[model samples]
Target: MKRFHVHVSVENLDKSVQFYSTLFGQAPSVVKADYAKWMLDDPRINFAISRRGETVGVDHLGLQVDSEEELLDLRSRLEVADIGFRVESQIGCCYARSNKHWTTDPAGVAWETYHTLGSIPTFHAREEKTSTAACCASDSGQAGTFNTRRETTRAKHCC
Candidate 1:
């Protein structure tokens, strides 16, 4: 099975959490000082929010799979599209450890396909100053950097 994922950067975490909780009719499953996540079964979406000093809007969209096989299946589909994507194995981000394939759609909207391996203590293992770390979508949703070499960018922490 797979769950739809949506990550958004917000100006105010508390306010955003309050609004979303009310809208969703439930509190988030995971709450941290700088981030919160709603593992909603009703809609089967991994909706997350963060105050990570990034643009205040939808950051990126993704598909979170349940097993490695499912992830590989998704990756194969991406490869068939030939749009180009980068793979990160056992990477830590969004307070979880995952293996991800990062890419951008035709309009430059960032897309991530991943399988969560486990949970982590921090948002990411460490801060990266380089551009070849993770993918981030700006407010325009088209200012994302895609280093073809690694297919990653650290414009902001990945979901």
Candidate 2:
């Protein structure tokens, strides 16, 4: 199974949480001081909000798969499409550990396909020494825009 994932960067955590909880008709399944997540079976979506990014809007979009096989299948499809992507294995972000394949769309929207491996203690677990440019590394070694904590413009988000 796969769940559609939407991550938004918000200005106020409490207000956004309140609004989204009311909109979803339920409290988020997980709430942190800087983040909240709602796993809605009705819509089959994994919606998350955070106050951790410089931009306060839709940060990135993704598909969360249930198993490694499904994740690999998605990767195969992306590869077949000939789109450049960056892979992060067992990386921790959004209070979870996941294996992610990240790519940017035509309009520069970041798209991630991943399988969560487990929970983590922090929003982003890796401590990269390099500055975040603006995106992930593409096949041309140029910066491509994705929300993962790659070496770019210091925008902090998760997969």
Off by over 4 Å in 2: 126-155
* Candidate 1 Cα lDDT to native: 0.76
Reference-based lDDT, residue 25, model 2: 97
Candidate 2, residue 34: how far the Cα is off, in Å? 0.2
Instruction: Evaluate all candidate structures by whole-model CA lDDT and list the values in order.
Output: 0.76, 0.77
Task: Report the backbone clash tally of model 1.
Answer: 1
Candidate 2, residues 53-158, lDDT tens digits: the string is 6689988889999999999999898778777667777777888888888777777677788899999887666535453322223232222333343335323446
How much is the lDDT of residue 152 in candidate 1?
A: 37
Which 10 residues in a row give candidate 1 its minimum summed lDDT?
134-143
Separate clash counts for every candidate: 1, 5
Per-model TM-score, in order, reads: 0.83, 0.83
Give the 10-residue window scoring lowest on summed lDDT in candidate 2: 133-142
Error of 1 at 49 (Å): 0.4
